[model samples]
Target: MKRQLHSCALAALTLLSTLPAGAQHAEPVPSEQRVTVQGMKNASAWFKAESQHFVVYSDTSRASVFQLLNNLERLDYLLRLYTSAYGKPQPLESKLTLTFHKRPGALAQFADTPPRDAVGLYSSCSAGVQGAGVLLAPITELANAELSKAPVND
Candidate 1:
């Protein structure tokens, strides 16, 4: 997991380096930077970590989960920079929910129409107030890969 996070950060930095020198820092608001982590009511013993744009629920260790989330934030920053420059920036109406499941088929249970042998799943409800965007991932499945190949699973 550390290797994956390291590679993700390195890739993000590499992308950042390619940006023009005048790039502005994409800092989260002070209030949004505050993080709250807690255990959820589930058989999987899920932990919830919420920040500015994402709310992650995982069965992984706190340190590793935070590391994964940090990479996600970095990607969001890059996306925002790109959208602001080349397209209409559509700010999120609510935080996106990301859940990492340890078991292979666990993620399918959350889907309205479960996939056939899916490694992960994503669902979004456009009519919902928050848009209800969610990403479900199989952490154990992805963890088997080497650093260079790790992100390909994502």
Candidate 2:
């Protein structure tokens, strides 16, 4: 899993390098400077749980957190079985933190807004070169906002 993240970051950098330098905003920022969310808590003031894999940061009930973790464990197990080049398994090298919002619309926004029905995301990052990251929406609220602006059907 750690390998995959680095590979992804490297691949993205390579691709970005190919684009015209003028079109791409390539400002070299130090990793420490790029991390704004690091100091901030991922979950809200309510309902937080810390584990080896993640810190469940949200107001979600413990029951929901357990259910979510069960799903994540299943995913991790599947990911470990995933074969890369030469048939190597992609195991996670680090613990990941997850923050859940009760209302989908309450989730964070990105450069490209997420879908209203987005359930969750594995990760997120700033536009920094090093690919420092964190993970997962108020898309549902945005969706409702957009729907309110839609033209009424006959």
Candidate 3:
């Protein structure tokens, strides 16, 4: 009787271990995914790091310039509203600048410019917002929209 009990316990343990090996956990869905925007001409966009300042850049086309500026304003409002709702009032520190470049390589050349300390501020503020757990969904949605607007490469 003692031997049979020990064997049963061992078998149960073995079965439990084997079950996990064959039955995998479901894969997690990604929270953020890339979004591609078509018909964006002369427009290349990226986020620049400046503490609490979100600067978007494009190759200085009239339409692209306006679109980026408008987007920044909207983003600013969203950030403010979300942060306030969390009982943390943190304002954006950086302004959006639109520089016009006459040619193709202009945006790349501008990208090489040394980043300012504002990047740190932006990161810290973002961390605080995330820590408060108030900005994730809206920010994720915004990021997805921005990415979808980006050009897709083959």
Candidate 4:
């Protein structure tokens, strides 16, 4: 009887070891749809800001994008300064269109800060366009506000 019991216990232990110890779980894969918005002139980088998150898109290399995203908090401060200097606070509902362009081998253009007139709308020719680094914050803030106010189901 003792021998039979010992063998049964060993078999049970082996069976348990062969089977999964517990429920298996897998981590969710991250989303792949990365949005890119191009900056003006020498900047020539795509900027995507979603829910306070920002990324720079570069066809040449990803380093630029990673740099921008990592320094977003500082960039937000710069944006507020630009908006205060050039733009008036309007209703959040105001829709503004922005265009991005790249200047070859001219990263200095971004540092120089193109005149407001040079960054105008594609169609209007008179409307001013601000740098992506400058405009992303207010737009993101307003978007977040709108989202929070939206109705939710329990």
Candidate 5:
């Protein structure tokens, strides 16, 4: 009886060890989709906001989009100022488009040939059509809504 119990326990252990690993960590893969500027514009649920230098489309709150756009404009100005010393300032013919997704999986669907685990995507157009210079990113939601407000630009 003791020998039979030992054999059964060993068999159960071997069977459990042969099972596939990481079953709990598996996630449902999102269906592949092509993302485009027009596609984003057609997404009725998305909110749109525009600044002097950025055209943002996001599913996040309007306040957050506006705040992000303001910061982006300020950063663009600073970068231009720094680079001006090196060469003549080249002006942008059109405002850049930024598409903000609510989650990383959503952003991945829009990325152009993205890696298996991409967090963000940025594409620069040297001489592309208007609105072709697009960026896809996930919004980092703040715990407090007050923190999303942009500082007043004097």
Candidate 6:
């Protein structure tokens, strides 16, 4: 009887070892790694803030969308402080549009000029229909070293 019990236990151990690593519980993919396809959210779906100070473009999810908005708001406040301390040649427009992309490659479609491998871009154009806005790449790409470390002023 003892010998049979030992054989059964060994068989069970062998069976468990043969199973795939995910047979028990698969690890969940991190949110940053689970990027959706580019342009998954259409331009029409962009959330407009109450102040119209800026518009958020992305399919990342409402929570992330709002977080960007808040960050922009804070950035604006900081800019105001700097301008007041120094002084601007002319008044600046408060309204803005932020284009947040799920992937770095997606920015090429919207760029008026050649796109860089930038993680984020604050850009504008002199004329010909390219307006002012900031383009944000995926959170995972934030540390890309190829692009300029400084933000593009336009």
Tell me the lDDT of candidate 1. Answer: 0.62
Residue 123, candidate 5: C-alpha displacement in angstroms: 1.1
Models, CA RMSD each: 22.1, 26.4, 18.8, 14.7, 19.0, 13.1
Mind giving the per-residue lDDT tens digits that candidate 5 earns over 13-119? 99988967655766889853333466465525566678887787676666667667766776788788888889885575577777766555665455556666654
TM-score of each: 0.48, 0.42, 0.27, 0.29, 0.49, 0.44
lDDT of 1 by residue, 14-116 (tens): 9988957897989876542323445744344556788778887766566666766776676688678878867775565577777765665675567766666
Tally clashes: model 5.
Answer: 0
* TM-score (C-alpha, index-matched) for candidate 1: 0.48
Cα TM-score of candidate 4: 0.29
Task: Enumerate residue pairs that collide in model 2.
Answer: 1-91, 43-57, 105-138, 106-138, 107-137, 107-138
Residues 20-104 of candidate 6 have per-residue lDDT tens digits of: 6665776987644234457675334444342346765564556666666766666667677888868764455545556665554
- Which ranking of candidates, highest lDDT first? 1, 5, 6, 2, 4, 3
Q: For model 5, which pairs clash?
A: none
Q: Which stretches of candidate 2 lie over 4 Å from their true place?
A: 1-45, 84-92, 108-112, 124-154
lDDT of 4 by residue, 29-144 (tens): 87544444466344323444322433333332234344444445555656777888687755542222322234332333454654443422222234533333222211222233
What is candidate 3's lDDT per residue for 1-154, written digit by digit as tens? Answer: 9999999999998898874457778999864223345875543433222223434332233344444445556667776778876766536544433333334333344345424421111223433321000111111223546655865322
Candidate 3 runs further than 4 Å off:
1-59, 86-94, 98-154
C-alpha lDDT score of every prediction, in listed order: 0.62, 0.52, 0.42, 0.43, 0.62, 0.55
Superpose all Cα atoms of candidate 4 onto the true structure and report the RMSD in Å to 1 decimal: 14.7
Provide the lDDT at 89 for model 4: 56
Error of 3 at 72 (Å): 1.6
Q: Please report, as a residue range, the 10-residue window in candidate 6 with the lowest summed lDDT.
A: 138-147
Q: What's the lDDT of the predicted structure labeled candidate 3? A: 0.42
Off by over 4 Å in 1: 1-44, 86-92, 112-117, 127-154
Q: Which one wins on TM-score?
A: 5
